[model samples]
Target: MPSMVLLAEYVSINGTDLSDYCRKAELTTKVEEKDVTTYGSAGWKELRGGLKSGELALEFLQDVSASALDSIMWPLLGTVVTFEVRTDQAVVGTSNPKYTGSVLINGWNPIQGSVGDEAKTSVSYPTSGAVSRATA
Candidate 1:
């Protein structure tokens, strides 16, 4: 297998493509671990998968101008919105699988940095439903 470099990542939220302002994007899915240790004379513990959940984290180069990053995200602070992310902006296929799901916009940091620092924002949102990966 070959390694992949993240030069052009695709990120979309609520039908809006925000790839230009996004610097980093990540999607993670996991299942809850449930223990079911029985009285089977075995001294080992057994585990099972339970609930499934996911989360999406993004880092953006802030652009607070009119109709820019701030304006677009501020209005979606308290809602569940759809999102999609891929390794590259090119057509989705075996090399570039797309991850799509809904995330709850539970938090935001419009301004947080020191003087003379570059404007940027990092946020993590919990998924509201199933996260699917497809290549088409």
Candidate 2:
């Protein structure tokens, strides 16, 4: 049997819950492929896995409050920060099917629009190390 996990679950950054302000979030992992095709080999190309990398993207309703801007901006502008994504809308650490890791803030963009539009921010970062996955 197979089960589905909803996207409207828990999400946190540096142990702080940000699900309320978060509109979209995604974590992607990829591996670099190295071509290993050599002479006297088959006509088809061959590849070998080289390195692994990860990236995270988040979209949030822009807020200028201390907890919203100050908290996130400082880390994004300063150093690597930890983030966690859970399967349920509970406290981060208390939930299952979680992914946690540290990442360096790569880019941040605050968007502003005319009337009848909500302000938002989009940020993305590249993972520095392994992103641990937990299912229980």
Candidate 3:
């Protein structure tokens, strides 16, 4: 297959376990078999939202052509563990990306007649206060 890669100006990743540990630790004090309580229920709960959101982003990427898959899934995801942003309308991007939103596929990718190196553009949006992103 040909090479496909998505680009974005920003990316973020979130993985918090402190609360989980604290809660579980507290629970253990109440139960006599506290040492036996090894299941990471709290951690699992926190991951649920992220997993669901990521699934939505992947489903959206399915609409992209095979050639665009790389730009939409590989490098951008590898580089960005949390959130992603694209200043330019390239690859997969949207005009309004929510905080920690999935990477937005280039929504306005077909623009032309610009200045500066074609490669210089990263994640960008006009002064419309819109939200552009690489996934969501």
Strongest candidate by lDDT: 1
State the displacement of the C-alpha of residue 74, model 3, in Å, after optimal TM-score superposition: 1.8
| Descending-TM-score candidate ranking | 1, 2, 3
Q: What is the per-residue lDDT of model 2 for residues 18-132, given as tens digits with 9 covering 90 to 100?
A: 8888888889999999999988566888899999999888888888777675456655664788988776775445345789899887666655567888887777889889998
Model 2: CA > 4 A from native: 1-7, 69-71, 90-96
* Number of colliding residue pairs in each model: 0, 0, 37
For model 1, the superposed segments whose C-alpha errors exceed 4 Å read none
Q: State the lDDT of candidate 1 residue by residue for 1-136, as single tens digits.
A: 9787899999999989999999999898999999999889398899999999999999998999999998999999999999999999999999999999999999989997899989999999999989999998
Better of 1 and 3 by TM-score: 1
Q: Name the Cα RMSD for model 2.
A: 2.9
Better of 1 and 3 by lDDT: 1
Q: lDDT at 8 for candidate 3?
A: 30
Residue 54 local lDDT, model 2: 95
TM-score, every prediction: 0.97, 0.81, 0.18
lDDT for model 3, on a 0 to 1 scale? 0.28
Clashing pairs in 2: none
